[model samples]
Target: MKRGVVLLGAALLLGGMGQAQTGSAGSKVPLATGTGGAVATVDLDASRAAMRILEAGGNAVDAAVAAAATLGVTEPFSCGIGGGGFMVIYLAKENRVVTIDHRETAPASFTPTVFIENGQPIPFDQRVTSGLSAGVPGTVRGWQEALSRYGTLSLRRVLTPAIVTARYGFVVDQNFRNQVQENEARFRAFTSTASLYLPNGQPPAVGRRINNPDLARTYETIARQGAAGFYTGEIAQAIAATVNNPPVAEGTTLNVRRGNMTLADLANYEARLRPPVVSTYRGYTIYGMQPPSSGGLTIAEALNIMEGYDLSAMSEPEAYQKYLEASRLAFADRGAYMADPEYTDVPRNGLLSREFAAERRALIGSQAAPGSVPPGDPFKFQTDPSYPLRPAPAGFEGNDTTHLTVSDRDGNIVAYTFTIESIGGNGMVVPGHGFLLNNELTDFDPVAPHPNVPEAGKRPRSSMSPTIVFREGKPVMALGSPGGSTIITTVLQTLFDVIDRKRTLAEAFTVPRFSQRNAATTGVDLGGENTPLAQGLAGLGYRWAPTPEIGRLTAIQFNPDGTVTAAAEPRRAGGGSALVQSGR
Candidate 1:
């Protein structure tokens, strides 16, 4: 398979054009493209892996699965077979958008107070690193279901690159090295983790090659035997055993409550097919993942509220204020109402209703709200009276996930976001499996008697926003990001940049970002802090802080002339590539 060059500098090198200047930020992003197919991911290897499948005549879903599997091998800290996620796909033949909810589910023995002891909640670090935080993983089933349902390639064919990479190993880049250094102490605590990442009793240096034969075998088994290979065999036993009986480091006391996950839990897990949440903004239809993910509804609500304002006409400062206000209002409702739909009645219709957004829009004044805006009564607009209007509770989310977008010549598109929760999730490898388990259970509110509290067989709420945009019933864009709770705001701002400000795909991603998630102060990226927008916001009596990074957005845009453009986030050390056909 032939690959396009990924240029890194202020200028982007297109196929015909020598060097095209990007936005004001002077980004180093390589906006890859192809008339036949395009794939964008945070890792170059993963993007290339997907492109290989596309070159082999597989559709977008097949290429997406290949990319996702390759990412598990290369970027294991973010996501792997042990984690779960959401996928939003657009099928060209069917001319329809669909969503699959593979979010992790809590064990049947779980209770609202599972993370609580005596009358107080456990320390976050303790709970986050404990085996008790492991949820029933659904990523394997998700990959299998996607391939079986929509893909033309066999599982073995799609997973070859990942298996080979895991066996032969790849050089550790600066990003991979940095993550290992940051978590070196925690990695040292676990024998399995330490052995894989910490070579010679130290974190591997940049450019050092690392291999994981154990993970290679695991993937190879799944490829041959299908999802059952991981969910109902030795691999499943290893996952359950590690959770039920956690390993403790010498001279360190682990304050953890063990999980009661049996083999049955793994076998019973299933990825549900659901309808994608739909909304309209300036004649373009936006589709996103539904329940178990707060991203879709929250983004829709924010967009609805912002629709009342003319963002393109407003100055940067003025527009940012409205964006922040809308985000706060949407987050307020997200905290109170968004959860697993099967476990609780989420006011889905009312939350996304334009009428309800109008009511919330009235709350935004010339200045920001005094403090955290209270959640609105969306239940009043819906028929579900059982949906309680509860006060929002405080929770924590981490920016440890990866997102990918793929588009094929046939017009099929896939936008996927997956995570293992926090970095080096739970700090425990499933014995010899070589993949970290997710702490997704911690996404639930630790406090008892709350809407997002953990429940038996209940999926945890997520902020992974995999979105697709369509114009006149044809998909024009597919995008998503990974920033924990900030994912919604990042995606929303990008949408405004492209749709409202009329910026190119590169400009939309390169622009400075600001996020306010119902917090006392809004977080401004490094560039935003030095701009007049920051000063104007401060003068408006708003507190602002600097964030090193907000989110890593990977996007693919389809042009009216049948061309494809793909861009990856330049803020991080990631790249993208496209596959061109012989003709066209």
Candidate 2:
């Protein structure tokens, strides 16, 4: 099996080809048709809902919140109220860039020994599932905060589409069906999950009308009462009681039972909004999520390193070789110094400085550095790993996520990425909430000597890089994706292809891309692990897995004339781009 491809007992394939529809069941009608409107989301319904809100006097911020809520309904497997995420909003009127960090945080009761076994590392399976793996969810709180400060629509209105879909039901698109089938065993293993995800004793087929009344009730409660409904109300109580009160269900795969998770964890959770980490690459200013998320710094570092070389003149093989080298350097620094700024002393400013970036890039030779080049000296970043190095090897843990971009005619833009942190997270579902809790804690290293090693109440490093681009201090594009650690590279590459290489939004996304995250997952394997693209990279001194599959990416760029251009990844279905014309 290759990286980024779906792997499970059910053998479900991603990137399936099918006819596009207008979001209505079996209708060939297109969903978006406008000039000034653009939405890039995991599902067409989700995107259309946001655009509709924008059409109805909602600001970009308002539309973004609604779009995010809608995604929780139509694309539940990837993201929902059970998860936490990040958002980048460019407030046009204020001329400000704000980043909301609602990324999941460890429970207050979390301990370093949580995943340790007699002071040794725990097995992958144990570290992956159960209540212990879940973090304090912040999706609801995050969305609410974004709306309260920047939006004009009431929570009730912004949440209506999601509520309607959950109550009335909607067709189970092929992508949804495939995701369910792929994780069937995990879903079946837990009684709570089995009851809801497998309502009819099996996952629904494509076009099957699937209604989640439980989720509807939960959404209704949240919409009416605000974020408090999901955090401290009946919904929260039910979740805490259900998982902790288990009687050893028949098909459970977890060895440990119950574990400590208090309702306090939910109630005390709060999402914070901070300024985005910004850097200039060529003429475009890039804005991405700040620390606690290494994505922004790593992207800036990689782009800066790549700038040292004249990649355009290099052959395909040479270009790939340099790309891998630069990525390795970035990953090294990320592993060594990146962490949640609230908990660690990360040098945020230094990481994005021109001097540091140029110095880091100078280490890359014309050829592939022998072995993995360690992070260069802090001052100069030498190309040789035989010299002083950074941290030990990074681990490979798969996570699933969704991305959305919303922009209104007023020039406000919001780019967002949300995730459950893994497919069928913890393989457990909140009893009646109809969503899976995230396995985000697994993102922390189980062993020591790694900067992101598990710690009490510490946020793990993440790659959910919701980003925006500015030209002459004005928002020009908004994009993000669900590619696990590959997210930073993919988003950065797409932005480069668009602004630097002069590719259209669709063309930039469709163009062959490469990624390098470490030895376990690198850009040299660009075609992905099991595909022809990987084979091609392998022939060029890159040791990619035989399988070639890369992560799915969705993006939208704004044309100064007010037209919106968008592109959706084929992995999650609904790849066609939609544009909403200005109402004026």
lDDT of 2 by residue, 381-460 (tens): 32323223236466655557888887777778888888888877677777867777777888887777556766766788
Task: Estimate, for each residue in 116-148, the C-alpha lDDT of model 1 and write its tens digit.
Answer: 888888889888878889999999999999998
After aligning candidate 2 to the native by TM-score, how far in Å is the CA of 414 from where it should be? 0.6
Candidate No. with top lDDT:
1
The global Cα lDDT (0 to 1) of model 2 is 0.70
TM-score for predicted model 1 compared with the true structure? 0.93
- Candidate 1: where is the Cα deviation over 4 Å? 1-29, 253-257, 383-385, 573-584
How many residue-pair clashes does candidate 2 contain?
21
**What are the lDDT scores of the predictions, listed in order?**
0.83, 0.70
Candidate 1: Cα lDDT at 30 = 52
